[model samples]
Target: MNLFLILFGKIFVFLSSFLNLGSGSTWPGHIALSINKNFLKDTLTKRKFKIILVAGTNGKTTTGKLIKEILETNNNKVFHNEAGANLINGVASSIIKNSTFFGNLNFQYAIYEVDENTLPTLLKFFSSDFIICLNLFRDQLDRYGEVNIILDKWRKAFGKLKAKTTLVLNSDDPQIASLGKKSKAKVLYFGVDEMRKTELEHASDSTYCPNCGSKLLYKRVAFSHLGDWMCESCDNKRPIPNLEKLVSYPLPGLYNRYNTNAAVLVSKSLGINQYFITRVLKKFKPAFGRQEKIYINGKTLQIFLSKNPVSFNQSLMTVKGLKGKNILIALNNKIPDGRDVSWIWDVDFERFIDSFKNIFVSGDRTYDMAVRLKYSFKNSHQKLSVFENYKEALKFGLKKINRKEVLYVLPTYSAMLDLRKILTGKSIL
Candidate 1:
């Protein structure tokens, strides 16, 4: 019975991709769920495969990629949700594709990049041996409501975890670190030291204590609100993470350092080979569009998926460190992009005006993005160009960036996908 369902779903996935309609990331699993609501629960739970679920708002995809590589380098066969599909259906699809015709799982391990909001429902079907919760922030306000709602959902969901299931979390994020309070499992944490990054963004997501509602104070901020924090009223402070020394990572930005820290902690807690983990950290490649760089015609084009404010700010910092001038930002309001384009205003773009020589804005919501930039770059002296379409924008972007300069592309979710298709003739999703 399960084999027949697998065949049916695989056919739909094939047809979807063949027609060039989409990446077929979710439709197959959606149809499979319609046929058997217990598909994921029945298939996944029946297997002896040890599963590790990576869930959070920002770093899920990148962290999941790192963990997957570590596991594979350690000689474990892993099946992962690659390009951030991340929902329940996507998880189901990843499992289904790795199964034999008789519905037996071929892999020894499954590392799923799960959506933060879907963690409760998805875990109801299957429990992970390890759960890596990176951090939470205000992202896609239309879809997530706010950070607190998901925090409550996770609190309830984590309460159901078994005693043996280890919860690996970022100690800097009070909301993420606090999920283990009710869980009977062993909780492990990872965080940067007190002197990683000091300057804090003016607009941060978590500034108050989750328990006492007192204003949170950061001793040293890594990015946004993630750092060594303490609450004066409740005496809640960032946990001293039970982790070991990690080799330096090649990935850019302080955010990537935090991500590597989280990955190292989870890998250690899982009893993975430390030698392999350290080597993988030193030799890690950019996951998907997370700081991926390409060289074209003696010049370089670096792509950073800055869909939200914190991520955009980090990308801006990365460009600043490299002393880049050619910057192109793409915006889109598609379903995956949260349909709310107002978040662009929340990002700190004014700081880059004096440093940047040329800035190009384009995407589905190009005009709206351009208007947001106009407000910031009005006083600063910088060459700004706007295009309503991506094609014209890419032409201008490629032409403006000289061989001696590096062009940095900052794009939202859908815009990143479209940009990849235009550049490499392939879709990552």
Candidate 2:
């Protein structure tokens, strides 16, 4: 019965792609779950696999990809939700497609990037040999309410891991480091030794300590509120760095530094050799749509997925670091890209006025975003154009840049998906 259901879901995936029903991000699992809601949990129980569960506000997908790569580099068979699918249904879709008809696995290891809210429920079903918490910020505020609420859920669900379950943490994030204090399981922390505060976005929810609830004093903020955080009233402080920037990472910004550090330490803790990790870091490209670059006609187009305030600010910082280039920003308020469009106000879009040569905007909320930018611009001469239609915006944005000149695209989740499908003539799904 389970085999038949799994096969059915696999068929749905193929047909969905063939007939263009949007590549089965939801339906295959919906159909499979209708047959067995326990399909994912049930399948995993049959195999005593080594599991790695990664959950956080950002960098979950990239970090999971790195871990999968490192494991495969060492010749380990692994399964993961690599399509940027982190929820229960998404994870189930991956499992159904990857598993044999009998719900058996060919992989020795499973690397999963579970959603922040999904972590609690998934933890009730299966356990992990290692779990990595990248960081926590208030995202989908309508959905999750507060950072502490998600943190409490994580602390509770993750607290139940077996004695051997290794919790890999970001020592720089107080919200992340606090997860280690009460754990009976082995905990490994990784962070940068020091980085000067580049651009501070006060929109971060990490201004207070998770331990004592007192204000956090950041001696240096790497990006957003992630930094060398210290609490005046409590014993909670940023963990001493176990791993720092080893090499000039392939990805941009201080955020990628944290991502690489977490991946390096997690891989090392799993007994993966330093040599393999070094090579992985050297060769790793940005996960697609995450600073993913496309070149055509001597013009480079970069995609930076900006979903939340901190990431949006960091994306701008990424643009600011590059030589002034034409930029296209697309925003949408789909369910996947949080319904609340209010976070746009949180990003310091004003900072980009001096950074880019030309700015083009598109997506569902282009007008709203244009209004936001109008209030944000500091320079009177900055060229800002708005397009409600992405095709025109893509054309206009692409045409503005010439040979060796880059075009940076900053997009919300849905906008990124839609534009990628159109740009590459391939579904980002």
Candidate 2: tens digits of C-alpha lDDT, residues 1-429: 778888888888888888887667656776777778787677776676798888889888788888888888988999887556778888788777787776677887888888899988887877778888898976889887988888888888766777878888888888888897777888888888657875446767777888778988888878777888889898678888778767567687778878888888878877999888878778988888999988766678899999998898888887788765688889999898888899889988876766677989899999988988878878463588999899999888888878777889999998998998888888767
Q: Number of clashing pairs, model 2?
A: 0
TM-score of each: 0.95, 0.95
> Superposing all C-alpha atoms, what RMSD in Å does each candidate have to the true structure?
1.8, 1.9
Candidate 1 regions with alpha-carbon error over 4 angstroms: 15-23, 194-199, 378-382
Can you list the residue pairs that collide in candidate 1?
none
Compose the digit string of candidate 1's lDDT tens values, residues 1-429. Answer: 667878877777778778887766777787788888888888877788888888877878788888888988999898987576888788778766667767778787888888878888888887788888888877898997988898899999889999879999888887787789889988998887635656678648887888889888888887788888899998888888875235577687777777788787877766897899977877889876788887766767889999888888888988998888889999999998889988888899887766888899999999998888888875843477989988888788889877877789999989998998887787667
The residue pairs found clashing in candidate 2 are none
Weakest 10 consecutive residues, lDDT, candidate 2?
A: 193-202
